[model samples]
Target chain A: MKRILAADIGGTTCKLGVFTPDLELLDKWEIPTDTTDEGSRILEDIHQSFKSKGDDHELNLAGVIGIGLGVPGPVDFNNGILNGAINLNWMEQKPIVSEFESISGIRTIVDNDANVAALGEQFKGAGSGHKDVVMVTLGTGVGGGVVSNSMLIHGHGGAAGEIGHLYVDYNRRFQCNCGKKGCLETVASATGMKNLAVHYYESGMTDTLLKNGIEAGTLSAKSIVEAGEKDDALALKVIDEVAHYIAVALSSLSAVTNPKYFILGGGVSRAGRMLTDRIEAYYRPITFPPAYENTEIVMAELGNDAGIYGAARLVKQFLA
Target chain B: MKRILAADIGGTTCKLGVFTPDLELLDKWEIPTDTTDEGSRILEDIHQSFKSKGDDHELNLAGVIGIGLGVPGPVDFNNGILNGAINLNWMEQKPIVSEFESISGIRTIVDNDANVAALGEQFKGAGSGHKDVVMVTLGTGVGGGVVSNSMLIHGHGGAAGEIGHLYVDYNRRFQCNCGKKGCLETVASATGMKNLAVHYYESGMTDTLLKNGIEAGTLSAKSIVEAGEKDDALALKVIDEVAHYIAVALSSLSAVTNPKYFILGGGVSRAGRMLTDRIEAYYRPITFPPAYENTEIVMAELGNDAGIYGAARLVKQFLA
Candidate 1:
């Protein structure tokens, strides 16, 4: 009765899941992430939580086949190194695979969180039936993961799917935290939408309900999306502007990876069809014809569970 | 002692190569492409030429393992379909694999010319020893091919490497043949360079050796590169502009595939260090940090023979 363990390690919490050898989820739980002491205690905390769970459930560690981890930064997949996760307060290359494997006496694999989330979607979410898929996660920052030939592409530096950093804002409207001006993340992420709203407000077009939020610097993507749903002009304009940049990024992605599905995930994507429809409108007229005609823009279905599922799927793929 | 044959099917001529199972080139030749009658006789002519070559060289058709083709158009690799090669007058889907196999009594594989060329470079040219590579072909038209994880990525609709179509010109300066405005191809291809020279001349910046040629529509990418070599201001300006757009496209490619080597090829690449150096300069500050730091821009070594080598590489991969 061998089992698999998956952990989606985030800044504040770690989501854990237990799966059978065949990848059926048996159990799932969460534990607060410890970020103090250079995040050195995080791995031990995860290991101890699994141990406690095992004891409570009469689960034996020896029966675990492997552990798969989704980390919150770029990963050297082959080497199993998590490279500099600032939010996790781990700014150095951590030997994730070796540490986890040694701690649990099981084989372990690690990949970037966004990449694993994409793998999760490709396996069971919106991209389930597609071999080629691009998952764009528009959360705090826009993130991307590309799957080609049914395998995640890590690129030469494990940076193959940094679609958020793609150059899109031609006017250099906002500077991305990635030290680049006019990145896709500057206008398409949750923060990017708010930035767009502020930009619109500053441009003397302040005739909207979002004006108070924009002026107070308290505008949220969720609020803007909610307003847009109610036919608010500024909110719709902001959504359209964000969708345009995203569409530009997707069009460029089409010319590069040309995936069958562009799965939109993250907080920003919760706007649903309103965002997707506008993105499709902007995407179709500009993307490479073959790709534009074939690729679909769909909402991600996995939500918060994508990372855990993707981690489990990584183990499944490894077993295969 | 089995052999593999590769054919690079272009509009004017088809370059053919014979190779051992080890992929060492044994012989190479060329035949004029008969693009008349909607390219109906193209496959048959290739088979006949191969037959003649085999007869003259004491080669037996049965000893050949397979034939690989590189066609100058979008290719449905799995179905062996050429979706529409306007230059070859192939306006409809042509069953290239079935037609070639039936005509020559050999197994066959077909891929896009730009894609195969990238595979060729990845196998033996500047990208040798690199699993992740991208090849940008700056010929009459800009073409691209991406190889990730040491394999060519044809995308869902076999349009993965259409880097030429990436939206780059923020000004929407020129209309692309792909029915899009502001495509990278409109500003980076050989003809694109000529168009830029014309645009510059029309805008009253005409104090160079290219003025008469631009006015007469006889301006060539070669003249521009040579003039740039001699520090001609107008030619340098055009080269810089082309490099800028190409760099923008490559930066976006970094966010997608993030290959280790960007192999520059086709006729315009012969401008050598003058072009690649400028492209690297523009690319470094803009692409994703990891990709920008790790990826190297290099010149294509195989030149005209890249297509044939790449075509043969396709068969080798198939056999594997």
Candidate 2:
């Protein structure tokens, strides 16, 4: 029974999963991320957990094949180095794989978390059976991962899937956190939705549920999506506007990569088919004809577990 | 020494070249495109030209290896099929590889001209020594080609490099020829520059050299570039505006593919560093910081010979 250890490292927590080579999860847990001391304790903590699997989960590590980690920033996958991961408080490049492999006596692999999530989706979620998939995560800020021909496109400097930074509107006066004006992240993320609702409310529009929510200080992307689902005009308008930006960005992406499926995930995607259906409606017309006919947009299935699964996939690929 | 035949098929003319395995051009010539019969005579003319190469240039075909073609449309590269090349009167999918291979008794390969041109640039032009390159041609219309890991990204339907159709301006009222509004092609092409000049002139900003050319019906993208070179304010404004659009589109592209270099080519690129330098100026601020720092924008060096050279490279790759 060959097994693998996988970790999805984030700013707040590190999710650890034990999986069989067949991709079946045997155990999963999380630990608070220790960002103090330049995150020096992170790898040691993971190694300790791996060694204590017998005590923690009644599972032995004697059959472990390797470890795969998904980190929240650019990664030099070829060298298993983490490059400038702000969330981890590591400004300098860190040799991630060697550190873990030295402790565990096993091979290790690391990749950007977004890219890992995309690979997870391609492997077992909404993008299953597709050789090419583009996954967009509409969270606090948008993140993306691209898999073409069943392989991740790491691009030069490992910056290939930075989808949220795409400039979507030249007219936007507000600057995105990335120091650009009108990035897709400013219009398509959960924060963007709230801002859009506020912008509409501030523009002298009244007599809408969203305005009422704003007046009550209860305005949120979830509330707006809930209202839009009920056919509220203002909420629907905000959703339509957000969908337009996302669809336009996806269309532009389609023209360049032409992936077979676009998997929408993250906190915002929990709005489910309401968001996907609207995005699809806007996507078809803007995409090039040939690509429009072939590419399909769908919601991700694995939810919060995608990252760990993707990390496991990374190890699986290494084994293969 | 073994040699190869390469053809770059265009609407008006088909350029043919003979190249040694090392990619040196042995001979080159062009013939008018006979697109009168669904482009049926096009291949025959190419074959006749190839057969007569010995008499015209003293180049014997006894050592010919293969033929590589660059066509003006989407191609199913695996099967060498051309899909709806409007410029070539090829509305039906044509099995170009087998057709040419059967006639010449040699292996044949086919790909979109833009993709081939990108490969050509990667092999010997400005993109030389780079494994990842994105080439944008601002001809009458914008055409693009992408190379990642030294392989052309054909996408799902071989329409991957359709960068021209990316919607850049949501406020645009005029539709592009692709039946979309605000496509990058609507602002980045030679025709797009002329249209921008007309748009500015129509907006009542008179007293410029471009206005005089427009009044004389001689306004062209080249004339606009020339005027900008002379520091004509309105022409510079138009050039700046066009450069802004190109920069934004390239920024969006960088966020996704993050190629090492962007190779700008075609008739509009004849403006040389004047255009590329301005585009880089605008691009740096909009692109993601890491990608902006690593990626460069440069001009293609092969000029009209790029397509033919790229075609020859295709055969060389096949041989390798």
Candidate 3:
């Protein structure tokens, strides 16, 4: 009758889940993430909310086995510390594990948000049944999580799965936030897609809805993708270009880890087949032959719930 | 005391070693690889050599716990099968582990040569004391092995760590044996270096000892790297270009699985500090910042013996 608690902390919101030891979500909710005082109050806020939730559910807090946190930053998993979360305004190392454990009196595990999402997908979503998975999350920016042999590959400095920063566009046409030109993020992230659309439109290939979106100051990755789905020329071109860059990154990733499944997640991934089809087409001819023959491109199935599921699963895995 | 047997099976020679369970090498030797008849006799030949070595050294073959084989191809590790090895004319699936086990009456474990070599380096060479390591072997061709969290990452199809095939040189200038254009192997291998020398020379940059070597058919990756050490113009340029591509590949690798150390081995690595220093210089400016700061590029310490050491380590790890 043991229970588990999980949290996926992001820039704006924190998703919380209460689950049975078997990982069945009993209840889930969200709360605003307060960035005041550099997120110093975040852990206390989370603890209060969990306490209230347990009370409301008539749940015994003592039955909770542990809590897992998916934070928006690199994590020193061994120490359960957030390296730095710029998005959360926690720009210095935060001892999340010890603080959370002390407040909740429960064991805690912490990992990068993207990595946990990948674990979630691998455990019960797109990557279900696959031991090796690469999940690329295309939200405001691009992020990735690599699972090899069913374990997250936290690189030397917890920078293992930064797929977005993979150098892809050798022409260096676009600059990434990471101070690198030609990164996959420069062309495939949501903003990167918008930028590509603008680049294409300004380069005299302007016969599309993106032009309207641009002049109206309504240009966004979603609109561009919708236009592309509707066969808008410039938007489709941008999709093609984005898919190409994504495929390039996947090809390189294949050569490196050769995961069985490359799961596309986040808002942009809702493009689904429209994006996966293009990626597979471009990926087939370019990726390492063995990887091409063995690996599959899939869509994320858990949607927004992936983070919470991943977080809970992290606790389950750690306990196991 | 329990003992272990290890073999590194290559195209020309098979290096064999005997080690105590403590991994202390008791003896080592080599024999010509009988690659005749599609390599059908390979297991018997290895067994014969091991038996002879045991007799000569008064070794108790009965005390050997297991034998580990490092083969020159993709492996189905779970099945203990060589998927295929073209260099040894092993073009079809071969159940190496079972066959060797049957021949030698010793349990067997098998892995790709590059993978075991990486494990070797990680266990006791340049990667000693590091849990995550990436080893790049710049031999006649470029090969790589990636170890993460103290385990080799053998992707879905055992095609993980195929770093030589990483897509580089967006220009698609050179063709790789894998039928790809602009792979890391197309520019960073020993032959790749020679080809770069040829490309540079043909493009009218011919003002070095490389020209004389080229004219004399003595142009080698070694000669070019050595000449680069003495500041030969064309040779230095080729070295710079090779180092650039290697750095680019490393940067991408760092973004993927930022290992603690990049162990450079094989003949091309014999260029020593001249090659590593340039690689580091170029690598520092391009790699993911965390990786650049945390990962160190070092020369392989085990050299030709790495394969045998790695092979033995494989048995050790498998038994553990």
Q: Top model by DockQ, which number?
A: 1
TM-score of chain A of 1: 0.95
Candidate 1 residue lDDT tens string, B143-239: 9899998899988888898988988886778888889887888899898998898888888888888877887888899999988888888899999
lDDT of model 2 at residue B61?
A: 57
Pairs in clash, predicted candidate 3: none
* Candidate 1 lDDT by residue in tens digits, A65-140: 7888999988998899988899889998888899888877878999999999999998889998889999999998
Model 2 earns a TM-score of 0.90
**lDDT top scorer:** 1
Query: Which candidate, 1 or 2, would have the higher DockQ against the true structure?
Result: 1
- Scored against the true structure, residue A24 in model 3 reaches a CA lDDT of 90
Residue A53, candidate 2: alpha-carbon lDDT: 71
Residue-level lDDT of model 3, residues A162-239, one tens digit each, is: 998887777778777777677788899898898898888888987787778887777999898889889998988888
Each model's TM-score? 0.94, 0.90, 0.94
Give the alpha-carbon lDDT of every model: 0.87, 0.85, 0.87
lDDT of 3 by residue, B247-284 (tens): 98998899999899998988888887777788888777
Off by over 4 Å in 3: A55-59, A206-208, A215-217, B55-62, B206-208, B212-218, B226-232
RMSD of 3: 2.3
